[model samples]
Target: MPTLTRLLSIIGLIVTGAVLSMYLLVSYVEPEPREIIVEIQKEGFE
Candidate 1:
């Protein structure tokens, strides 16, 4: 039981570290703008 607990704790730490690193990396980077087009039909009003 102790071994299992220790293993889980280690895994939890690794996952937490990975998530924090990813969050920080993304926060430091800039994103580019994307263009989108939409079309509406006039017939819908009638």
Candidate 2:
């Protein structure tokens, strides 16, 4: 029972750490802006 409890606690801590790190990355990171262009065939415009 003690081993099972320890294992669950370790797993919970690892999951919590992962979630916190992901939250930090999402909150702090930024993406570059860019312009995009597309070409269409003349037939498609008809």
Candidate 3:
């Protein structure tokens, strides 16, 4: 039916808009990485 088609089209447009906005937002934002250090203890001599 025409109503079903219209609903799908609206949903598709909304999804597309949301995806584009998120892409732009993320592209402009920079993420900082945290540095992690790990140490291991040896009980026996090698």
Query: At residue 34, what lDDT does model 2 achieve?
Result: 19
Better of 2 and 3 by lDDT: 2
Q: Give the TM-score of candidate 3.
A: 0.62
lDDT of 1 by residue, 1-46 (tens): 9999999999999999999987666555623112111112334444
In candidate 3, what are the lDDT values of residues 1-46, reduced to their tens digit? 9999999999999999999987666555734212111112232322
| Candidate numbers, best lDDT first, in rank order | 2, 1, 3
TM-score of each: 0.62, 0.62, 0.62
Instruction: Candidate 2: give its CA RMSD in angstroms.
Output: 10.3
Higher-scoring candidate on lDDT, 1 or 3: 1
Q: After superposition, how far is residue 40 of candidate 3 from its true place, in Å?
A: 25
In candidate 2, stretches whose alpha carbon ends up further than 4 angstroms from where it belongs are 30-46
RMSD of 3: 11.1
RMSD of each: 10.0, 10.3, 11.1
Count clashes in each candidate, considering only residues at least 3 apart in sequence or on different chains.
Answer: 0, 0, 0
Candidate lDDT (C-alpha), each: 0.65, 0.66, 0.64
